[model samples]
Target chain A: MYVIVSGAGSLGSALAASLVAAGHEVFVIDPDAALLARAQEDLGSVGRAGYASSVAVLTEAGAARAQIFVAVTPSDEENLAACQLAKRVLQTPRTVALANQPDNVRLFETVGVDAVVSKIDVLIANLAGSLPAHPLLKLMPVAAGSREVVGIKIPALSVAVGRAVREISLPYGSMVILVVSADGKVQTGQPDTVLQAEDEVIAVAPADAAETLWEALTELR
Target chain B: MNVIIAGAGRAGAALAARLAEGGHRVTVIDPDRRTFDALPRPRIDSGEITVIEGDGASNDVLEKAGIQEAGLFIAVAEQDVRNGLLAQKAKLIYRVKRVICSVKDEYLSAIYRGAGIETVNPAQMEIEQVMAMLGGV
Candidate 1:
């Protein structure tokens, strides 16, 4: 797949390297020539030192033919604008962006950004994993953040513990894909499989259904 | 009408003052408190206009500036990209009826304009003014 990555920052560089290693053709753009040069060494000479939002820069980087256009610039505005230019003007099939602000997530997704990765949201979710308020940790967002894969831990004092997985009412558009036992055994989540304390259930769910699913599995009946 | 002007630069402050004089509730949001100096003191002191010292690109700042009830949002921040992004948020997220982004770069302005957001390109406007002065060339 042909990928156009905007920004040669740490995240962009890592992603470009991974995409290149995966055998995908990658072109990176950044206003910082030094950073772009450093990133180019890992990928190839396919780097442009310019704003990705520039039509000329994107044209030179072959954005029109790119299968994926991902912007991870420090500026959320730059990321969003570059993705918008790529998706709308260049007709790139998929445009992903790093939303620097947690609030920009909804705006970015609604503005037709194919996917949005909010570091703030991830950091909060990570930190909140230890907090009782956040029972499920979002592993990844799919379908432009409308849905996500979450890890829901079964608490020792939970109502669903020892109950069949099928008996727990997972919300609409949510289902347990896998369950990892306390002994670190990973297995497919079968409908009849009984839940156990300390079991880490990995589930795919609509983003809004997280609270309901978490409560259903963790709360006392 | 309720108006929120992002950036208290000369343009933003002047616009805020003029809008407030027009009887519109105006709020000027900027990251630098120093920039708020551009705003007329009497207007801010009298509560004819409000000033918020915060990043106008941020959602919190916009919310604090009363974006929920704003009818118009103007982004005249230093960076073209920041202005475009804020304008989009005000229009799409906050559901503001009108949004205008001041983008100096004509190319960037055109791109934002293509996306259905209104934009005023100072550079392009200057060129147009010069061309008009040159008498229909």
Candidate 2:
């Protein structure tokens, strides 16, 4: 997906990184130079820095081709304004704005923004704090509704360390280990390779199995 | 400024390639000798970047990589926790001026900052981007 994010704050930068990792073409529009620099450093090859509120910058950032245009600046007014510019000037199909204040969320919807995400709504959901809920939506409420995969360090004392991966009993679900970081390098899989004390394992399991998997992995200890 | 990367993993390799293209002295550190195979040795060398396979977390490795004079320190290894630890170590232990760490977890990224370290969480960033793309927000 080709996306233009109009904010380089925490939320904007986070979104930019996620999209880039998912192999999407991303352009970030931020008024803050430091945030843009940090976003560029983090996303590397897939990031384009721009001042998105301006029509020239949006045009140059290819907003016309954007599948999704996000206005996530801290200010609700700015976000709404950016969304308006995106819809009217750039002819962007879908524009979303982050309403830092809940009061402006309804206003955003009335103003024709495709979506308005309020800070309070986001915060309440994130308060649950379930690890591995959704790797992508770390602090968002979406994790509870979506499947999750998590990376964990296999403690030497865990029951999972000694047995073969297939033989190791786990919660009812499909399981796959994507990568194992041992001695500071990533290895995709080694069936015979024993899970050692410090090995970092990226495990894929159902989101609901998070607690169960954690217990099962640590039960033998 | 002369920069030395502590790991030659994907991020490290990419950074080296970019910094080298920009005409900066880059030296990569990794214990796995195989990383040298994946890295463009001649291109990096021609661009004035050096690759030394060794444990960058160790003082010996850093000393050999000229850590004493390095202005920038980037720890892009596999471990987020270790990256933060390395950043702290680089700042306090080695006194490196600029240190950047790569973390995958968003929660940990927020927590790691308390240790006086800067972090880049690619996964969290991806999440934010994907959310924007999918939800149009």
Best by lDDT: 1
| Structural RMSD, model 2 | 21.8
Weakest 10 consecutive residues of candidate 2 chain B by summed lDDT: B106-115
For model 1 the local lDDT of residue B78 reads 80
lDDT of 2 by residue, B14-130 (tens): 898888778788888888877766677777657588888775655677788988898898988877644654565576666787888887744445444554567888787888999
- Which one wins on DockQ? 1
**Candidate 2 pairs with clashing backbones:** A14-B125, A15-B128, A15-B129, A17-B125, A17-B126, A18-B125, A18-B126, A18-B127, B30-B54
Clashes of each: 0, 9
The per-model lDDT (C-alpha) reads: 0.87, 0.71
Give Cα distance to truth, residue A188, candidate 2, Å: 55
The second chain of candidate 2 has a TM-score of 0.86
- State the lDDT of candidate 2 residue by residue for A63-127, as single tens digits: 88998999888766457656766787678999988977664565467557898888887775465
Grade the docking of candidate 2. incorrect
State the C-alpha RMSD over the true interface residues for candidate 2, after superposing those residues: 19.9
